[model samples]
Target: MTPKEAIRLAINGRTDIGQVRDENEDHIGWYNHPSLPMGFVVIADGMGGYTGGSKASQIAVKCVTEHLETLPTSTFQACTPDQQLLVIHSKILDALNAANAGILDAKVSAPQLANMGSTIVLALVWQDKVTIAHLGDSRAYLWNKDGLCQLTSDHSLVQEMIDSGSLTVTQARSSRVRNHITRALGVTEFIEPNINTYALIQNSLLMLCSDGLTEYLDHGELEFVLSTHRPALECCYRFISEANEMGGKDNISVGIIEYTLENKVSVSQANISVPAPSSAPVEDVTVRKESRA
Candidate 1:
């Protein structure tokens, strides 16, 4: 078997009500099927008021989990690697769409939840690869010996402003419109998520989280926590605790996955340094736009 097919993964997840939030609207999930070589980790941040927001996030998690659980393992295993990736990508999109429709239907049936919405980030792992899909601002980060890098971009207005050169990163962070998101599930009839696949580096780590943790931690802080060489579950707890200590403005949810080869190679640590914010204005970053089917 190829190295890609001979990999194993360790995963752990946690969610907490921050110091300020009365109820936690963030939901996290990780599942490894007994019969398949695939697994997934998901994080969702609910929007709107407490009742609507929590319900929206819960529904999104449930729908995605059920969809993945019911996928036919035999059919997936029959495909080539490339074909398998495409199938997984399609299923991710379908699952998101299904959740969107379900949320919309719920809003229609219950007038009180009319404004409910959610941001979702998911990572699907199989063999030595990970397929990431996301909507709105929930994020995914990759960490290895090279340090940590954000794999998913935020769909928030502040992020757009920063990318377009209209606002600096420092300015965007404190902007009044920082929380305004351009894309979300359950807010409309349809949603288009950004999806990408990457080959997993042995002894590397992947983190999926809500904005709550990111709102308090910067790139350097995140790198520090992830590079501690701790167990996946410990890492999840540490991230949540640190976020809360930093003011914990929102509900925090974190999911961590550690990928390793059969031989258990060790990952080296790097002296991480934060880059200074760019002085020159940046051009607008183009996103892969999608329309409803």
Candidate 2:
């Protein structure tokens, strides 16, 4: 079954190799535990060369999503309502660290791939709350009646330039160092992933994606896309298609979680009931599109 049909909370995701890249170095996905109410949405953008970038991105997604999905549901369910959010935060943080370590470990024998690293953004979605942990430049955004609000701060040099008043937002868009991220998975022995938890209002849409989509569509264009009021899957496809239309400068990936009344749980409740799932989780399959040169 497709993610729209099989994934909980109307979650769906898609990724593309883009027009230029020989291999897709981006990964996007969301998967829930076999019996837990929580789900994980991860986006990773890889850098380096010699085919190592793709592997790094794949390792990032695999490490974070697999580790988080298998977390003990009973431990989460057993927590007090107030402690549940904390548990979510810790779980996401721990998983991100693990992903960082996994990427470092993969470089053990391959000397040429030593510089390979990846940007990551992971959202742990539960009832009315999303705890995000990220490193490097992949981002998380929430779109609602209020419009699109960027949920994650980029860990790129351009971002630092913007923060330090050295580069205006417009200038940063075209800055030579825009792609030079300040940090990434496997770059350091210990990683400090940024973490934040947000209250998800009903009808709000949470999007996790790589920089390729953002490089093309600005906030206004994204608003226009959402104004179509399309289903989660359609909106995600629009994101990928539009980015490709804009010259697909890099690999593109998108994962969306639409929070509606149906997915909302009571504030007092620590966990929601999840229907039984099969032995293996269903993955969203993406077709890599080739550009017409």
Candidate 1 stretches with Cα past 4 Å from truth are: 264-293
Candidate 1, backbone clash total: 0
Ten residues in sequence with the least summed lDDT for candidate 1: 268-277
| Sliding window of 10 residues with minimal summed lDDT for model 2 | 284-293
Query: TM-score, each model?
Result: 0.88, 0.84
Q: Taking the tens digit of each residue's C-alpha lDDT, what string does model 1 give over 101-205?
A: 778888999999889999999988876677788899999887887767687878889988877889987787788998999999987665767877766644578
- In TM-score terms, which candidate is top? 1
Model 1, C-alpha of 95: deviation from truth (Å): 0.5
Runs in model 2 with CA error above 4 Å?
1-8, 33-36, 263-293
